[model samples]
Target: MTDCDFLVVGHGIAGATLAYVLRQRGHRVLVYDPGQANSASNVAAGLMNPVAGKRFALTWRGAELLPFAAAFYRELEQRYEQSFFSETPIFKLFSSLEEQNAVLARSADHPWGDFVAGFDTTDPGLPGTHAPFGGAWLQHGGHVAVRELLAALAVEGTRAGWLRRETFDWAQLATSSDGAVYAGQVRARHVICCEGAAAVRNPYFHWLPLTPNQGEVLDVECPGLSSAQVLNRGAYVVPVGGTRFRVGATYRWPPFADGITAVAREELAARLSVITELSFAIVGQQAGVRPAVRDRRPLLGPHPTVPALSFCGGYGSKGVMLAPRLAVLLADWLDGHADIWPDVSLQRYNTLQSVGVA
Candidate 1:
């Protein structure tokens, strides 16, 4: 009997994006952050790149998803009168001649291969390609100023009386046949959990085999670099355009102790040295567990028995590029518009009772 229509857990990117959508749809949302450690979104490099490097495959649903993400962020920028979308080019350094050839060959296969800018220049940087190699240019591959955007939205929501800040204690959550018992607002007809890595702890959906990873990034000072672009060979050095930059998002799987680790910093530092000659100090280090699922796809849909509850998380490292479209689909389903992204929907998993295993 506290208050709220929808009690969204976690204020990270997943929750934030969903909340924004709900608000736009004219629903009340009370987010429960609980003031826990920031999740991956807080410390993410925020690079929304369409072309995946390793597999040389575009992001899953990248064609449709990227446009949604770009438009969504752009709309937010317009509404809030804030500028966070910085369109910069990203240069991917090739590791070997073989990789460069593969990239060039793939470009030939696609008619719109112009997006993949290829260069014959053999030199990229010191400790250059492992073998004779160059790099590929990717347009529309830039970063979101997540920190600034989150802050701006929070302030906007607060002033408009659309948001409340507090820890969401699950013990207080009571589900009825109809909807949910939140604080007092009773704003939403349903509750969606976007709690990132912590979703594993929720009693209702913990069994979903989530593989959480604790990732850390080093905030370094690089004043001289003119081009505000993402440079990658081994580790990515994303320019933040403030004489400061973000580098080395080292991923540590199998859950370890929380907080930044020396090993992670050292590893990141070693990688950063590959591209930059200037010495930079680690001005800041932030750590958060990414909400990763074993399937590597987002977990979406409603709870089996408790139809009033639903969730959308586990986009892993690709949250920036994935969340907007997924949120739209969730909003559509909630608004009774359309059912989409069935692959990651919650309906895929039966309730604990149905499975006979907790």
Candidate 2:
């Protein structure tokens, strides 16, 4: 049997980042992933937006989390010598005059002004976009190439003989007060479940309200439209490379909805149309389940009953912006160097009474 300090399931952004951090901290880490193509991390555009929603509210701890995440990705890029993270401005086109006024008013009095790179009053921001109400260029916003990063991590982990590319069978998992043994082939001091939306089915941590959210995105080839910035108007048009942009993300409820639908395609196309007059062709469509929580914050810390079991999922759509810092915190907690914040700790659910299983 192979002995390790930690066994992390699911190689999505959350698991991958956590595993990398744990390994970097000099722990023996084994990552188990089936490499499902439609997993949320694989399909996500990895957008890092500090301000979100129609109200343009700042993300939870945006000031601290955004910069920390950027530095984390940069460190990884430097270590691996690869280009996976892009630091670009996000041009948020205003949908109406009221929206523009609201942002301006907020910028005048609130801390939102710190994130505003520029604000246009009357002119359309981008060349082909229909920004009648103008837009706001947000600073400290960008994207990470999640798929590439995962592949790079997998390569390094495999090279180190710690990453296993196979399905993990729950039936064969054995756990005691000391640690966990998987299929009697891998033994670890703790087993961290990063199983994204699939965590709802995990027997150990299923009670934590892990809501699976279905999201879809479209890949388009727009020859006429070109910009280094991500253009946003409800749905965003992210520049991938040379005329290829990813137009995405429609949120749908009731998770595990398989396959992409024409309705989503139409909705995305309509959103893109409202954003830009540039002609485009939809080259591909993808659907995945985001492991969102009912409260929309990440779930961290050990299982209520089993100290050998832990969880680090529930990143939702903000995984790209939130995972890196959260991973470090989780690693610190695991190493007995820090405590998990109450807001994100699994104990916040107060569901221990019902969680009698281990």
Candidate 3:
């Protein structure tokens, strides 16, 4: 049996970032990944906005976390020798007078007003895609090439003898003569599961209020729309590698399937037809379950009873902005240090242990 310090169950951004943090703290980690774990992290546009839209409020810790995430990715770029983090501004266009007034009002006088910009706009770039009419520009909202970052981390783990690229079987989790087991044989001091939406099935952690969201996306080759600026109308259109735009992300309550959905495709196409000038070709499509929670916070910490087994998941739509810092907190807790974040800890979940997380 291969013993490790940590046996992480997933390899998406949350898992990858957490594993990286653990390894940086001089611990050995063995990751069991299906290479097809479904989560928005792997397939998201990876845009981290300082000011969120729903209520035009600043992201939980936009001032601090945003800078930390930037520095972290830059350090990773130097460490792994890759350039996946793109520092770009996200343009949020106003669809209604109420929305415009809200943004302007908040920008003129708000605690996080520095993140909000008014009046300045992007001259019509793509006709097919919704061009910015007028709204707000949020600085420091950058995009991370999340897939590339994960791939880099996986390579790093394998080189360091820390990652196992394979499907994690459910039967692998069992109690040993002494205590808990991870995967099949990797007995460790502790096992921190970062299994994305599948955390809903973890016997110890399934109780957390993880409201899963099924999201869909379209990968279109909009050669005419290739620009560094991110555009947003009802939805965001992010520029990926050359000529390709990762546009999309419709949210559904039901679970997600790897298979493409006709409803999602139709909705995306209809939305795209609203205002776009670029000649585009649909190149690919993807669907994944977002690890969203009831109060929209991530589940982090160990079980109240099963102290050896822990979890860190449920990072809704803000995975890119939230995962890095949360991972650091989890690592600190694992290393005999106290958990700094008490508000979103799993202990909060066990408060009403009878309630099951969907």
Candidate 4:
């Protein structure tokens, strides 16, 4: 017999959010974290962009994901009593005349017109920031203080008696006809792996093509360069309060190692220099692997053979916007109230045949 309803491995944003949702559904949950040295959730700037890239196209399912994400964060704020989410605008700095025309043309269309507006030199609202061809203001996008949110949720999870700090030993995990037994540690009706990039190492569901990408970011002190909106040029410059700004994120796949490098640091500095002429000092540098999928959609659902084993991850850089809503879906599926979305289902790999569809 299982001692708990679920055993959630990896307490990152994806895992934490799933655990939180399961608890709300009145399930007994126990979260396990091996304490990796680097985690993308902690290193991420947590920017949720509704419209992305130089082409100024709407992000995948932006209209639905944005609102659902906003409500999720708001509910988290009220429940955790922590102010961590900031609803700010994102200003896409036009790179050239041709780029400017492309975005402007898209903004003049339907749906895109609702969230995008053109702005010239008068905007960006800061000097030294270069936007020779003007830019676009993307509405309904902002940043989340992921580190704070994750920390707060960890505390709440502990208080609620649903968290354990220890490495999950797969060798000790024994699956059965009904559930899983984690040696003498615990028996659980479900074992959900929200292991992020570590999912690549997951034995049960590693067959899924999860491409882990290493991303680097720099936390800098830019005195007198604060802005209410995120500046997006080649790279993003997000204000994190006071004189601190998180400038980031160079995506490098098949990384040689898992730490900050001089090359990445220089690239980030150059990106910051191009977007804003503001002088800044690097406060710190961080690097973490993002759990990206080949198809660019999140991975979800249970193991074909072992019903108790499940997975929910690969939100990639959009974890801030995707995790919350996905968590709800995961919980519903686990409770037999709904089925996992086909797009994200691991069954798509054609490697595992479903026992039966929900």
- Pick the TM-score winner: 2
**Candidates in order: C-alpha RMSD to true structure:** 2.8, 1.7, 2.7, 2.9
Residue 291 lDDT, candidate 4, scale 0-100: 94
List lDDT for all candidates, in order.
0.75, 0.88, 0.76, 0.84
Candidate 2 error regions (>4 Å): 352-358
Order of all candidates by lDDT, from best down to worst?
2, 4, 3, 1
Q: How do the residues 215-304 of candidate 2 rate in per-residue lDDT, one tens digit apiece? A: 999999988785778988879888888888998899998834578999999999999999878889999999999988888889999887
How much RMSD separates candidate 2 from the native structure?
1.7
Write candidate 4's Cα lDDT for 1-358 as tens digits. Answer: 4399999998888998899899888888899986664799999999999888655678887888888988889998998788888888888888888877765565555657466654663344565577777787777889999989988977776686677778787878999979889977689989999999887777776677888999999999888775778989888999988888899889999945759999999999999998777789999999999999998999898887887899999988999999988999999999899998899888787553333211
lDDT of 3 by residue, 1-358 (tens): 8877787888888888898898888887889887873456777878887876667678887887888888888989999899978888777766666776666676656657577654544434434445454666778777999888988887777787778888776566775434457555668777778888787786767777776788888988876663667776666778887878887778888545555798988888666655466567888888888888888777888766766778888888788888888888888888768655877787776865655443
Q: Is candidate 2 or candidate 3 better by lDDT?
A: 2
TM-score of 4: 0.94
The positional error of residue 353 in candidate 1, measured at the CA in angstroms, is 7.0
Residue lDDT tens for model 1, 240-349: 76777888688888748679899999999888776766677789888888888767888887887787788889888888888888888888888888985678876565
Give the TM-score of each candidate. 0.91, 0.97, 0.90, 0.94
Q: Looking at model 3, which ten-residue stretch has the lowest summed lDDT? A: 120-129
In model 3, state the lDDT of residue 29: 80
Candidate 1, residue 64: the lDDT equals 82
* Candidate 1: Cα lDDT at 50: 67
Model 3: residue 207 alpha-carbon error in angstroms: 1.7
Name model 3 segments beyond 4 Å from true: 37-39, 121-133, 174-179, 255-258, 354-358
